[model samples]
Target: MLRLESVYLRLKNGSEEVPILENINLDLEDNKFYALTGPNGGGKTSLAKVIMGIYKNDEGRIYLDGKDITDFSITERAKAGISYAFQNPPRFKGLKIKDLLKISADENSLRAILRSVGLCPQDYLDRECDSGLSGGEMKRIELASVLARPSRLVIYDEPEAGVDLWSFENLLQLIRNYHKRGNVTSVVITHHERVLSLADEIILLVDGKIADRGSRDKILPLIQEDARCCWKANCGGNNDEVECY
Candidate 1:
């Protein structure tokens, strides 16, 4: 349902321009789950931002449902049924959860949205979204706000970041359920093995370009091999020595 045509992006680091995404052309089908994963600085998040219109592409165009949206504003993209959940959810010191949901989505679906995130409406509806809440709570709150209105496509930038194990599992279930819905597309920017397993296709971005994209069998082994060398404490075959990052 989404397409990118010769997409290119570069950013200025002081005086030099560094390429973030180079000639990215992708076609994401409707109702499919695609995971974007790769090494640090591989431009996964940059590509997502370009799709969401958070960053303008240096060249080329982005189209959603056959319409060119390369120039759409972030708000305009949201209005057109696209949602992007940030890696670090923002805090609103004085905003209550109920008020945040009401402003972000259809007012009638507040309770349903909370429940969709596995939160009890009665317990969290009155709670403030401030430092008092835990990181997991904040993440879920942000997700709920983005999902307040029904979206044709949702891009989650590293949903597992900053969440505890318990919250991470819950987030996975939430995403799984969302993907089960018909005719909606999901793109997740993540490095977690569990998240990678959930994707219909795994896309490995390397050095600002797509290195490979295929089924789990074709891609997982490659990444696992790289992870074993880089992530393992002593680069040993022992399972206990592996430190997941």
Candidate 2:
């Protein structure tokens, strides 16, 4: 389990301090799937970074399983059972896919983990993580690497980013199946409806604060309402990108 108390994070903007996260008090139970969704610039990724220790709070404490980890560095947090997958994962030109899985998996399990992410071990296990791979491929490989490694809390900042429509479904199923196994907590920062609908709870962040959080039935409608409002104000008669989140 993880808990954040009175968390406040602000970044410097010229001579002034701009608030990134304000009074973010949150509690996430173990073995549950949480979807963090909201409009752009609402501080969703910032909050996740704060939890992952990439960003330190101006005031507050971060606790994982009752231990205060506010002062923990990002590397310490990862060693403490927290894994974060970036929105745009970096390409390690010489690192093969299996090299990542070797952190905690054996040869046999490495194949299984690749298969779980819809990649053929024989085809991709030896392939380098370079510019040749598509965005979706790199995302899946990054996701699988994190999942294969033992971690109590996994924070994925926009797993759907740069993914094609076909790959998005697979990514959703990957998260769903992993959550079903229990024992590990999954927090996915996404704006996609299908991803939000799969969560045990939907957390809405607005203006750097917790606006609302509840079941899909309760929160999905509110998000849809925001889409409609966004359509009226910003869509410019084009229904393609709603800018809802």
Candidate 3:
């Protein structure tokens, strides 16, 4: 289980302290899938980073299975069974795909891990993990690495971004399979309705605060209603832009 108690974060914006997250509290149980969604710049990603120790929280505490990890560094957090998949996965210029997979899991498991993400091990194993690979390819490789490692908590940030519709569907199915296994707690930060619908619970963040949180059946309708209003017409009085509330 994971818990956050009165967590808060602030950033220096040209010498002024700006609050990014405010008085946040959450409890995530094991073997459950969660979706965190909100408008862009609402601090959803920031909160994820804070939990992973990419950014330190200014106040409150973070606990993973009853241990306080608020002051833990990024490496320390990973060692404690926390894994994060970035929205834009980084490219390792000289690393081979097979080599990276070997680092996460044994050689015997490499082929199966790649196959889980719908990639042919023979086709990609020798490719360089650099710009030569497409965005979708990189995304799949990153996700495969996450699956290779044994983690208690796994956070995926915008997993569908920049992928084709077919690849996106494949990714969704992979995540669904992972959730079904119930080996790790999953948190997916996404705006895709299909992904949101699969979650056991949905958390809506807005303006650095949780606007709503409940089961998928409870919160999805409200989000759909809000999306309809935003896209149907310029409800916010601007002719060119749709306001996502």
TM-score for every candidate vs. truth?
Answer: 0.86, 0.86, 0.89
Candidate 1 lDDT over 115-224, as tens digits, reads 98878999999999899988878888888887666788999989888777877888788787877876789998998999999899999998799999998889999999
Model 2, position 97: C-alpha lDDT score: 75
Count of clashing residue pairs in every prediction: 0, 0, 0
Worst 10 residues of 1 by lDDT: 227-236
lDDT of 3 by residue, 36-87 (tens): 9998878988999999999899999999999999889999999999999888
Instruction: List, residue by residue over 145-204, the lDDT tens digit for candidate 2.
Output: 887777889999899888888777887788777677878999999988888888989999
lDDT of 1: 0.87
Q: Which residue window of length 10 is worst by lDDT in model 2?
A: 229-238
* Pairs in steric clash, model 2: none
Tell me the spans in candidate 3 whose CA falls farther than 4 Å from its real position: 231-245
Q: Which stretches of candidate 2 lie over 4 Å from their true place?
A: 13-16, 231-245
When sorted by TM-score, best at the front, the candidate numbers are 3, 2, 1
Candidate whose TM-score is highest = 3
Best by lDDT: 3
Model 3: lDDT equals 0.90
